[model samples]
Target: MTLEATDVSHGYGNETVFDGVSLSVSTGEVVAIIGPSGVGKSTLLRLLALFDAPDRGTISYDGEDVWRQPEGRRLEHRRRIGMVFQDASLFDASVRRNAAYGLRVRQSWPERIRHGFAQLVGEQNGTGDAVEALETVGLADKVDQDADSLSGGEAQRVAFARALAYDPEILLLDEPTSDLDPRNTAVIEDAVLQARDRGIGVVVATHDMHQARRVADRTAVLLGDEILEVDRTERVFDDPRDDRTRQFIDGELIY
Candidate 1:
């Protein structure tokens, strides 16, 4: 599934954050929307996630305009495009239940239900195929812990695991590692790459340029409330094409 935002103008009341902002993300690719705090990076992600509709613009999935679709269609669209918030909040339930939250079924046999996560990550001991998922993000040991009991980083991993568990085609990340230490950040970074390997297109809104350069294939630099530059990670870091983008990287207020 591909996400395309075209001429997307959005804001609340008199303040317009973005205007004529457009970008595209393809499967197996990771696009990082980078900018300073409170610059509408998260707002743009919300628009792409279909959580909010733009005041004047359109969002499309594979060329089909989503804003034009009905509410039911929008729900289905969201199901296919799973979202991972900064603080990956798992329910107050068990780890197994939390991971299997995406796989919940009303008619599924109760006995076979818990087996969903087990099936995804085989051979219990938290050492099965699901182990691979956890191991990918260095969270293999906390598989049995309750969601609320986990640390910030661990909860985020569980959230990623849950998203993978859902097997969505598109992954939307909003400041996914704003709280992690360097060690934990690397682990989650690997997990993001794993998602790309699985052919899931990822759009991440982040403040960490280092992480963006490390994980993103393409970087979309948002400035002046619009995408100022969209290019390869290396090129973007080495040379930003926009004045506002350069100012952002240098930590200088554009005012």
Candidate 2:
């Protein structure tokens, strides 16, 4: 599967955020969007996640324009994609419950009732895929703890686990580890690579250049309200086609 944005442009009223942006990510590939803060990276991810419509272009999944589809079809497309935001907006519930939230909401009401009854009777813990996802984020032991009591980094890990539990075909992350410590950041990066190995298309919008180099198969540079370059990770770092890309990679370009 491929998730693509073609000639995509967006803005807030009269102020344009980005224009004429085109990018694609295929299954089993990781694409990184790198830019300084406020460069519209988050906005681009939102468009790719099907959370918002592009003002002047199309977002396509498998060659079909997503926004042009009927609401039911668009909804099905959204169900196949998962997004993790910068903030870990977890509910005031147990870690296990939070991790399984995505999957739970997608279930039929009757199924949810059955599961609830099973949990009540001790027939199941209701962990299901949440256990594996939490383990991937190194939080398997914290499954029964209150999500509200976790540290910031732990909370973010829970958020990533929640997204992973649904087994999305496309995963979009927006600066998921910006505030995490090195150890926690490494865990998240490993989970990302695992997702890629499972043939999931991953697009990560990150300010961490080192993280991009470590995890992305392809890197794209967004600057001056446009995509300046997109190429293999090593080539983008060592031999950027655009001087601006070189400047950005060398930390010489100031936002």
Candidate 3:
């Protein structure tokens, strides 16, 4: 599967955040969008996730224009994508329940009814997937704990597990580890690699250049209201085609 944003432009009111930004990510690839803060990296991820329509360009899933599709088709596309935002935004529930929330909501009504019945009959609630995901994020021991009681990093890991549990074809991350400590950040980065190994296309929006160099197969620079460069990770860092990209990478340019 592939997600592509072509010449996409987005804005609020009369102020344009970005313009003509084109990017693509394919299954089994990790693409990182790197830029200084407030450069619309998060907004670009939102567009790729199909959460919002581009004002003057196209967002496509496997070559079909996402916003031009019917609502049902658009929804189907959304189901195949998972996104983790900067804020963890976990529910007031157990860690297990929060991790399994996506799969639960995607179930058919009859499936949900049967699941509830099985739970009442002393059967497992089919949360093996959730458990596995929590284990991936090193949270298996916290499965029964209240989500509200977790530290910030733990809650963010729970959010990541929630997205991973349902097996999305495309995963979108918006500064997922910006607030995390080094240990938690490493955990999240490893989970991202595991997702890529499982043939899931991943787009990570991050301002952390070192993290991008460590995890991304390809890196795109978003600056000055456009994607100035997208290339292999090494090339983007060592031999950037754009002077602006070099400036940003060298800590000389910042908005």
Report lDDT (CA) for all predictions: 0.82, 0.93, 0.94
Residue 125 of model 1: what lDDT? 31
Question: Which 10-residue window in model 1 sums to the lowest lDDT?
Answer: 123-132
Ten-residue region with minimum lDDT total, candidate 3? 116-125
What TM-score would you give candidate 1 relative to the actual structure?
A: 0.87
Give the Cα error of residue 14 in candidate 1, in Å.
2.6
How well does each candidate superpose onto the true structure, as a TM-score? 0.87, 0.96, 0.96
- Clashing residue pairs in candidate 2 are none
- Number of the top-ranking candidate, with lDDT as the measure: 3
User: Compared to the true structure, candidate 3 yields what TM-score?
Assistant: 0.96
* Model 3 alpha-carbon miss at residue 212, Å: 0.4
Which wins on lDDT, candidate 2 or candidate 3?
A: 3
